[model samples]
Target: MNAGALVLVVVQVAVMVVLSPLLVGVMRQVRARMEGRAGAGVLQPWRDLRKLLGKETLQADGTSWVMAAGPVVLLGSSALVCALVPLVGTTTFPLVPDDLFVVVSVLLLGTVALALVGLDAGSAFGGMGSSRHMTIAALVEPTVLVSVYALSIPVGSSALSAIVEARIADPASIASPVSLLALVALSVAVLAETGRMPVDNPSTHLELTMIHEAMVLESSGRDLAWLELGSWLRLGALLGLVGSLLVPWGIAGDVTVPALAVGVLALALKLGVIGAGLAAGEVFLAKLRLFRVPELLAGSFVLAFLAVTASYLVVQG
Candidate 1:
């Protein structure tokens, strides 16, 4: 990579790492305020992570190499995505694989790593979390895969850079019915993937209602810190994808300071809108019973399928 691209890569990764937790905190604060309680400050997640890093870690009994290795792999995968995603610039890092499929696989790889860690921990809560998480994951995959491909159909390429570049060049590329439906599918995806709102509550300690938290109940100190940071970073990366792929205006297409500043402002605006919507939904909607999650995801699957069909029909007609 040239010096400019290298700088952007570092800047984007640092921004993501520093700001992801703030997004989570904002959501929490907003939800708390809506419920008539004074919320913690938006820097609460930052404070929690800082404290966790200083404390000692405790490992569960009978945990194998998987327990030790899992967080490293999980954090690595999340970091890889932060590096790969087109946050402010419409290009992939040089020498990094540029396909969206590669990006999706890396995401799924993180999920699999977490599942392994949960099983390796040998806690009933961990196993329950793993099973529910995997089940939701399997149902959600088709919607994600199809929605991405549907968005790509207009650009005629699955490369992440190409899709971003195409939409940046042709602003009308996102105005189609396919794009609209695909956006809804992705909206549903954001909730499930981020463990937010009606899908899963991030702040809850209830074992019967939690999916993501249960898996990490045994982690303490630095290990828990990695998981918490990884989760927020993962959400940030995915939200970046939603912005870059669906609403790609104002992203930098070249190495210019002015363009990069515009890109950062644009992304912040988009993520802010998304975070507010999620917080409001949390306040208004009730959590789905576990059995009904599949039904909700199935509806998302149909929307994604329709999005793909609509994209093809637009071309064919």
Candidate 2:
């Protein structure tokens, strides 16, 4: 990659790394306020990460190397995908990494890696969480894929940069019913996939109410720090992905400094909006029964299918 491209990549990762925890904190604070209570400041997640890092490591007995390596691998995979997500730049030669297939693969890799960590822990709670997580993941993945595919139909390419470029070139495509339905499906997938409320509660530790929390019950110290930080980064990356695909505004183009700056600003604005919506959902909605989670994702899959069908009809018309 050219030095400019390398620099842009670094900037993209750095921006997400610095802002990811802040987004989580914002969501929590917003939820607290909506529930009529005082909440931690938006810097709470940063403070929590620092606390985790300074604490000592505590590895579980009988756990495999996969457990020990899982947190770093999960975080590393998330960071890798963030670099190619087109969060800042639209496209750069020698490193125009915007393949939709790669994005989905990396995301699944992170999910599976975390699942391995949970299963390797040898704890009953961990095993239970891993199984539940995988079940929902299986249902959510297809919905996510179909939603993006529906969005990319107009562009004739699954490359995120190409899709964004096409959308920018014809902004009206954003308002199509197909796009709207696909986005709705994607919203459900994001909430379920990210372990947000009404799917799984990020803040809850109740064993009966845990899906993601159960998986991480065995990690402590820096391992937990990496996992926690990675969760934040994952949320940020997903939000950025949605913004690039659906919002597609102010993204850097032509590698200009001013354009990149605007892209960063726009990216933050989009994440803020997503975080607020998440907070509101958490406050207003209750977590579903484990069996009912499938119904939620299944509904998303149907919407995604309709989105694809509608896109073909609309595009043809």
Candidate 3:
């Protein structure tokens, strides 16, 4: 790889490592303020992670190797997603022909790993949570693939770099009606995948309503910390992908000092806006019942399908 690509990869990885916790912190602070409570500092998540890392790990007697490997795999997969995505310019791993599809599938792999680990613990809540998680994943994954494919159709390639390059080469194309519809579809998929409100409640701890958190109920200390960090990193990477494709303005194509600086600033700004919007949505909306999730995801899938059809019609015309 060229130095520019190498530098971009390094910078993107560093940004994911540092900024993941900060993004979580910002969301918590925004949610607190919106709910009329004293907000935690933006560094609160960092402090929590540090404390968790310093504490000792405890495992249940029935836990299997899958339980032990789940967190590592989760973190590794998220890091891989970060590397595959075009954060600064393009991925250093752009030569990997199926990076976009791999990015989507790796997320599913991590989720399945965690679900199996949750079941291995043999806790009632863990099993229940895993079941719900699988259900949600089943509903969400197809929408995510369809939505991404809608964006990929115009570019004629499923690789993330090609999508971003296509957007940058013809910036006006993103404002088309089909792209707008796909953006809306993908935005809903993002919420569902990220455990945001109107899909799943991130702050809820009750076993009856918990989807993501219940699966991690048995995790403590370092394991829990890594899982939480992985979630945050995944969130940022998803939002970054959306920004790169739908809002490619200010993204740097080269890794010169100036370009890298601009890329960092653009990433930060986009994430900030996304974080605030998530917080607002959480404050304003209520979580859907478990049964309603499928309908929501199905709606997104239909919209995405429409986007693909519309794009074809426009191109043909």
Candidate 4:
């Protein structure tokens, strides 16, 4: 990578790491306000992370190295996704083109890592959470792939940056039925992938309803810190993606100082708006039953499939 690309990647990753916790805080605050409670200030997640890092991680007997390695792997994977996705700018390494399949594969690595962590915990709750998680993943992943594939069809390439650039270059495309359908489907997939409401409530700890929380019940201190931060970062990055696709403006086309500044400001604004809106929407939503979750995901897949067919028809017409 050239110096410009390298600098852009570093900035994107740093921005993501710093803003992710705040995004989570904003979401929580929004939810709290909507629920008529005085929320902890938006800095609560950062405060929680500081406290967690200072504490020592405790390991239970019979737990293997995964208990130690899993969080690190998950965090590392999240960071990698931050680097690969076009959050700040479209400039990327020649060797790392931000291909759609590659990005999805990297995300799956974290998903599998988290699932293994849950299973390695050797607790019944952990096992149950992992099972539910995998079931959701099986349904959600295909929707993500197919939805993006529909988007990629218009660009004739799978690099996410290229797709974003194409939409920016042709803003009218963003309003097309194909784009609308694919984006909606992709948004639903993101909610499921990120453990948001109506799929798995992030704030819930009820054993019967827990999917993400159950996996980390055995982790504490720095281990838990990594898990939380990793998940937050992933959610932020994906939100940025959805924001960029929906409104592909202000993302730097060239890695110059002014453009980069605009990119950062735009990214922050987009994330905050989306986070607050998502939190508000969730307040009125109910979590679907475990069996119904698949039906919802399947419905998204059909939208994605229709989008792909529409895209091909548009091209051939």
Which numbered prediction scores highest in lDDT against the true structure?
Answer: 4
lDDT of 3: 0.83
Candidate 2 wrongly placed segments (more than 4 Å)? 92-96
The candidate that achieves the highest TM-score relative to the unseen native structure: 4
lDDT string for model 3 (1-317, tens) is 56667778778889988887888889899989888889988899999999999999899987988877898898888887787788777635445653567888989988887788678799999999899888888887887788778888888888878788888989888888788888888888888887888877888868888888888998988888888888889999888888787788777876688888888889888888888777877787988988888998999989989998988888722
Question: Clash totals for all models, in order?
Answer: 0, 0, 0, 0
Candidate 3 C-alpha RMSD relative to the actual structure: 1.5
Q: Give the TM-score of candidate 3.
A: 0.96
Candidate 4 residue-wise lDDT, 186-230, digit = tens: 999999999999999898869878999889889999999999999
Question: What local lDDT score does residue 3 receive in model 3, on the 0 to 100 scale?
Answer: 64
List, residue by residue over 206-315, the lDDT tens digit for candidate 2: 88778999999999999999988888888899888887768887988767789888988999999999888878867878889999999989999999999999988885
lDDT of 1 by residue, 220-290 (tens): 89888988888888998888788777778888887688998898888777777777667877788888988
lDDT of 4: 0.92
Alpha carbon lDDT of each predicted model:
0.82, 0.86, 0.83, 0.92
Q: Which pairs, if any, clash in model 2?
A: none
What global local distance difference test value does model 2 have?
Answer: 0.86
For model 2, what is the error of residue 51's alpha carbon versus the real structure, in angstroms, after optimal superposition? 1.3
lDDT score, candidate 2, position 14: 96
**Which pairs clash (backbone N, Cα, C closer than 3 Å) in model 4?**
none
Clashes of 1: 0
